[model samples]
Target: MHVSALWRHPIKSHGRESIESVELVAGQTMPWDRAWAVTHEATQPSAKDGDWAPCHNFVIGTRTPGLAGLWARLDEGARRVTLRHEALGELTFCPDDAQDQARFLDWIAPLCPANRSRPTGIVSAGARGMTDSAFPSISIMTTASHQAVAAPLGGVLEPERWRGNIWLDGAAPREENDWIGHEVRIGGAVLRVEEPIERCAHTTANPFTGQRDADTLGTLERSFGHQNFGVYARVIEGGTVRVGDKAGRA
Candidate 1:
């Protein structure tokens, strides 16, 4: 198996960016996989009775079709983060301070009016109103799996719909879901694939436009049976990974 692509979402639920390479660290994540997200204090139409929380508080979905177009870049040092959009100005955040968070919230709030219906940051430290499935952090998908999911459609689905942090290519399609609870090595790093990442409504939100689309859920449900497409891993070692880095079952 080989890596065909890689991605990271700086802001948890906002959008995603495809990458040629990335670096991994244990107990943390690829540079920007879940750095930010949107939260809802009250139950959303999708969540039913679940109240919103911070990015740290909940799991966001990547299965949503609308997030397909969002893209981003983190400066070489992983300090400056830039979003790509026409009307919206690019904003940066300091992961270490409230000042940066406030700036990011202000910059993002006005752009996503639909998010207004949901409540803001969670009262808990580092928690947000959004919720995600059972991964401590980070989501991954394979190019072959992506192609498999898109095969039925007679073409490829955009990467944004999957919203993964790392994209592995050349591996058997859907191979990731089967590797849960095992360790795999990629480039110089070793990681333990922990679990299959479940899908959620956040996938419905367009990271670029913030529009909600429900088709993504139905597609995943029909193709994969469960509302899931990827796996979660805890970095066991740190190293640089680049495009074409070989990923093998450990």
Candidate 2:
């Protein structure tokens, strides 16, 4: 199989960015993936900077589906991001800046549900990114498996629904599920496939429209007997992975 696409969510559940290549590090998540997250007014004890926290304490797409509509581009050096949404237009700011965080909360307020926890602030976990899993994980998916799920639902579904980090192009449907406890090599990086990534309400929301238009959880349960769509792997060997790089069991 070969790499097809790569993505990163600089802010947890807030925006997604596509990249042609990325540097993977051992025992760490993809650089800047979920590096920062927007905390809510209801956050208990509050999210402290330079510390990891569970996803529920923040504003996420599951509770506010409209957040899925966001598209983001991150400038790693400057810590700046340009985000766009059909309804909100565009915003450019540095997530680490206090003033910019306020601007971001205001910019995204329209997408967040008033009943849900109101967006309060943004925080970063330093080198330890705040992925849904307690440990750092890189999400891996394949087109064939995506097609398997989409076949029952109709045509090809937008891949962003899964929010995977690395998408492989050639593999049999559900073949990745059998890869647990094994190692997969992509370009120069070697990673151990640890576990299947369970499905969440986030997948039901359309990324472009930010609407709950698909029943991805139902489709997975009915067709695959599990609410899972991809695998979470931890990098064992750090290296560069680029689009079109060959990938296979190591």
Best by TM-score: 2
Consecutive 10-residue window with the lowest summed lDDT within model 1: 122-131
> Where does model 2 exceed 4 Å of error?
none
- Candidate with top lDDT is 2
Each candidate structure's count of clashing pairs: 23, 0
lDDT of 2 by residue, 4-121 (tens): 9999999888789999999999999999999888888877674665577888888888899998899999998999989999999999999899999999888998897868879988
Tell me the whole-model lDDT of each prediction, alpha carbons only: 0.61, 0.91
Misplaced by over 4 Å in model 1 are 37-69, 76-78, 86-89, 92-106, 110-135, 154-156, 204-214
lDDT of 1 by residue, 1-250 (tens): 6676777666565556778767777766676555555445543344322333333333233332233345677664655566655446565555444676566556655454464343354121122212254334556688787777666655645666667767777778778877888888888788888888776666555555656643556677888787777887877887888878888876
Alpha-carbon deviation at 26 in model 2, angstroms: 0.5
